[model samples]
Target: DSDSKQKKKKKSKASRSDEDYVQSLNSREDRNKSWWDDFRESVEQAEPEGTGKFLFLKLLLNETCEIGDKVLVFSQSLGVLDLIEEMLKIASERGEGLKSSKGFYRPWRKGRDYYRLDGSISGNKRQNDIDAFNDTKKARLFLISTRAGSLGINLFSANRIVLMDASWNPSFDTQAIFRSYRLGQEKEVYVYRLLAHGTMEQKIYGRQITKQALASRVVDSEETGRLF
Candidate 1:
């Protein structure tokens, strides 16, 4: 009994040590400025990195606008969606042929060239937003929540889709992509999945691929057996 108690205490100490080490590693700053100062500066500047998803979004939006193609941007987090909204607002103010209304983000007034859909949008309002994007050629971009737009929404007007973040569940991403390939979709659709290399996002994407491959094999086997 004394031996078992000693082993338990040792295990607890080991766990605590691991936690402390992780915390220390995380706390070590890579930049000269403190974390809070860096965060504040980043918010104020809002300067997107060259290879980052935000920069890619800007390029894609500009190209799509030139070609008169629509785009749907999906993110799982509301905070990210808000940031994107702000980016669009800034872009619009810079004579980018986009606009933002004075108040709430909902029903964003951007010269009829942009629309937004999220969980906050009601059924009717969501449909209205979708219709506005689909029915009009002026609408060039639609920002949506990954969860809210992944299911039962037909966004065939947008020939391009952008996954701003990766989800652990592969089905969510698949659903979001397929939303643009609905029944009335006549044009070829392009889907862009943005993931930071050497980060957790890449790891999550790898997991998603593994799950999809396994599921595909299972479905293929069942079909083959039925054919035999």
Candidate 2:
């Protein structure tokens, strides 16, 4: 009985020592990790399935493309446009087909199926892309920078306008929507404004609504006074 008790005590000590060694190794590894490693891990965990905004945008694109509708996606930031372009390219490489209503729809190809316009592009190239988008059946998506695309641009070819983010000034968003809702548009126009529920975007959009309401009231008051 004494020998058995001694053996049991030794086994218990060995088990505790093994557990302590594992905990020490884990602590050492954590100490060895740099800030960049921690940051990357956090980002990967946060965006395990890409961003919610981008995922919804992809679903919207799939539906619109399947029905043979062209889309104009506008973003206030050039960086956002760049990220979208990269996403589209990656989707194209994965053989993600848009499956248009037309019997012979092909897989989406950048430069052929989609176009981009921004301040960085030369005026000639911008006009050329616009023309291609307007004239070609294959061109189904156009990604535009809001500041650069809001002025003197006509995109009657696309009936769907996607506002990827809100603008501080409501007129910028209005102009972006009207790009596709012009005189020559044959189909019904649809506008989609994507905003994260608890973000600055919702605040900006609320402000935009208030500003528009105030402007309308001022105009109505002016008209009422003028009639008398």
Candidate 3:
């Protein structure tokens, strides 16, 4: 029994020594880190304010939503939509109870103030959300994936359309814009295309203009042939 107790005491002491060694190593590592390393760590941990394009979008939404105007925001990437949703949530929280053109503006809520539609959502849920947006007085913003929303959906309630990012194909964006500019839409629809100055988005926008011009020429030629 005495031998066993001695063995246990030694094991306990060794374990404590091991723990101290690990703690010492961690402290040493921290001390050895350079100022540049610390700065990099801080940058990594910092919360970003979002891209300039999205900041402008938040401002536009603030202006439009304050005036009781409904908006449809379409993006080619689901990831971009997700980012916009998070940014809008922050904006809503910040603008809570702010006075607007239409009296006091309430904080934007998920199902009441905005709706999101992506390929992952079920058809029934999509239709339900669409119906809600069209019928509800408070529903103002719709964040949609361009591919998922460009076809077979009518957002006649919204008068403002924001193309968050330009698509490679101009037809996709045209369809997205027309989603709000449908037959039942009584208000004049305005489309806003957001593009970064020095990025591939500008190139894509230029390409879209070229493609649209070519498409128009082709259609005109075909119509003339039919007439002949």
Relative to the true structure, how large is the alpha-carbon lDDT of every model?
0.72, 0.77, 0.75
For TM-score, candidate 2 versus 3, the one ahead is: 2
Clashes of 2: 0
Error of 2 at 202 (Å): 0.7
What ranking of all candidate models by lDDT puts the best one first?
2, 3, 1
| Model 3: per-residue Cα lDDT at residue 9 | 88
Best by TM-score: 2
Q: Considering every candidate listed, which one attains the maximal lDDT?
A: 2
Model 3 Cα lDDT, one tens digit per residue, 1-228: 999999998777546412333333444455456444545556332312345677677778778867778999998766566666667666557664223676665666788788998765677999999999999977878998787788899889999999988989999899999998989999988899888888899888888887777777886764212210
Give the Å shift of residue 123 in candidate 3.
0.6
Clashing pairs in 1: none
Instruction: Put down candidate 2 lDDT per residue, 55-144, tens digits, no spaces.
Output: 887888888877879999998766567667767766656666555665333566778899988665667988899999999987889998
Per-residue lDDT for 38-130 in model 1, tens only? 445654565432337888888787777666678999987665666676777666555653422332122335537677776556679888888
Q: For residue 79, what is the lDDT in candidate 2?
A: 57
Tell me each candidate's TM-score.
0.73, 0.74, 0.73
Per candidate, the number of residue pairs that clash is 0, 0, 0
